[model samples]
Target: VQMLWIPFWAAGIVNGVGHYWGYRNFEAQDASTNLSPWGVIIGGEELHNNHHTYPTSAKFSVKPYEFDIGWAYISLMQKVGWATVKKMPPKLQLGAVKPVADEKTLEALIANRYEVMAAYARGVRQACKEEIAALQARHADVSVLTAAKRWLHRDTEKVPAVVLPQLAQVRAAHPSLDKMVAMREELRQLWLNTTQSREQLTADLQAWCRRAEESGVAALREFSLRLRSAQA
Candidate 1:
């Protein structure tokens, strides 16, 4: 009964609290998160976000601070000739490249696109918060600013239609905030352009970098430069 109950209970909580609680390493479309970095209990299934981030990987731990006891057990089992590791996540290799993105850049982008978006989203959220705080200080307009911050990272459909006006208002009021939000969308759309040819994509990326730099948004320009140099 322990065997029956334990796995079922673990699965339920992992699917529940794992989605509702803890810090998300990646801003996944779904609200999946790591229950804990030290995944020793429940056979290391606590690292659910890492599992979702690299679904094919048998080892769930991704960071230096993380530990997957299940992976350790699998290694021990392999050493005793009772198990075998099958798959792992591919490494994201970003290297220097020409001004235009190449095949290697596309490959690397495809492999780690989610990670790229996650980082962009986090940066935008931080910038948004700082902007909102400044707005609240200057105008004592906590309600609108607070709502803007709240829905900043949510899925577009999840945000109330009424909040759209407030977002536009905030954007009009803050140049830096607007630039961060627009840059995030541009980065997302760049990857979504499947119809574009390789040459077109490379050209688009180069154009994006130029616009980003000219916009005078420090974070956006820095990220664009990083993207320009990225390769697989």
Candidate 2:
């Protein structure tokens, strides 16, 4: 059993529970999921979704919060002349905020789309909490706000079907939340359509920033400014 233990755990637990549960950094094709952000348990196989997305990359962790023990081991080995690492995860570098989002902004945002989306998701959650508090003070029905905060953290498609009507109610009831959800989907378009030329894409991104800034939502304005800081 000792000889078979490691392989059995790798084949069964890693590939089994790895896909069946946990969060994803990228929108991979398959159902692969990262079993945990701290990859000590499965020796970095916990970052299964990242593995599926970047099969050739030596690193598994992509998000800043995630840790890959396997990559740490590889790094130690390389330092000692025992291993070589070629491909690695991409990173988003932010620079001074530009007057507008340009081609460089578009390139960086696309290159680090997962990280960008995660940041946006965090922004939405923060905004929702503020909005919810304000609404509660006004004696509004704040029950929906709690659920809205949870569902809004996810992409529109990822939201459960059963909660669509509730989400619709939340949108209809709250102006700030409604605008945030609508603008979140619009932000997604910057990377989704690949048919557009660089000039066209840059133009689209510039226009997106303008709309976001003028949307009257403070969160949207801040997010747009952050987008302007993306450096390729």
Candidate 3:
């Protein structure tokens, strides 16, 4: 029974369904997901996406909405001096807006890239709402947006191959939304390029922020302000 439960259930089910289905807390590079926010089964392994995001974290649950039973047990052990925790996930904080994107801003942006991108996802959703309404007012074809909307918040590589044409169409139709999506990729490049010096990245970030704030898109401008306030 132990052999079956540990090897078969734990090894097979968690690894299988964990990669295949469920909501993601963080957009981990791989397809990992939380089995449930109330992670009651298989210790804390149900919070599989959280596990992938912070592989070394002893506590699996990160969000306020999530509850990991294994983390509860770990806390109990900690109270009894039976356990010790080491590394946990990094936090993304927002402080007073900086005058410019400096070295510290670059460091914070890179350190919390995933969280930063998730916040950018919110800005993308806003772009969607604004663009969709504008298109409706003009009586234009909204199918392009309907296609692009599903994948806009996701990474470029994660966008479905078939939907690529629709995304292109979206760009052609809506100039404001086009600028937002293109800027999203430009923002991602600030961290993706490794050869650039810290100073160079800071300059690049400053340039990016200047462009965003001046882009004429209200959502993009607000997002730049939020980006300026990010802290490590």
* lDDT by residue for model 2 (1-232), tens: 4334547766889789877789777656576888889887666777999998888899998878999888898999999999999998777788899988888898898888877777887778888888788988989878887876778756667667998898999889878878888887777876787788989989988988898899898888998898899899
Positional deviation of 135 in candidate 1, in angstroms? 4.4
Expressed as tens digits, the lDDT of each residue in 1-232 for candidate 1 is: 4345548756788888988788767656677789999987677778888788787788988778999988898889999999988987666666774576666676676678876766667666777777767766788666776778756655566568999998888778778878777766666666778898877776676677778878877777777767666667
Show where candidate 2 strays beyond 4 Å. 1-7, 24-32, 52-55, 62-65
Q: What does candidate 3's lDDT look like per residue over 100-188, in tens digits?
A: 87888888989988778877887788779888888789998777687688677777787779988888888887788789889989988
| Alpha carbon lDDT of each predicted model | 0.74, 0.82, 0.83
Model 3 alpha-carbon drift over 4 Å, by segment: 1-7, 136-141
Write down the TM-score of every candidate: 0.79, 0.86, 0.89
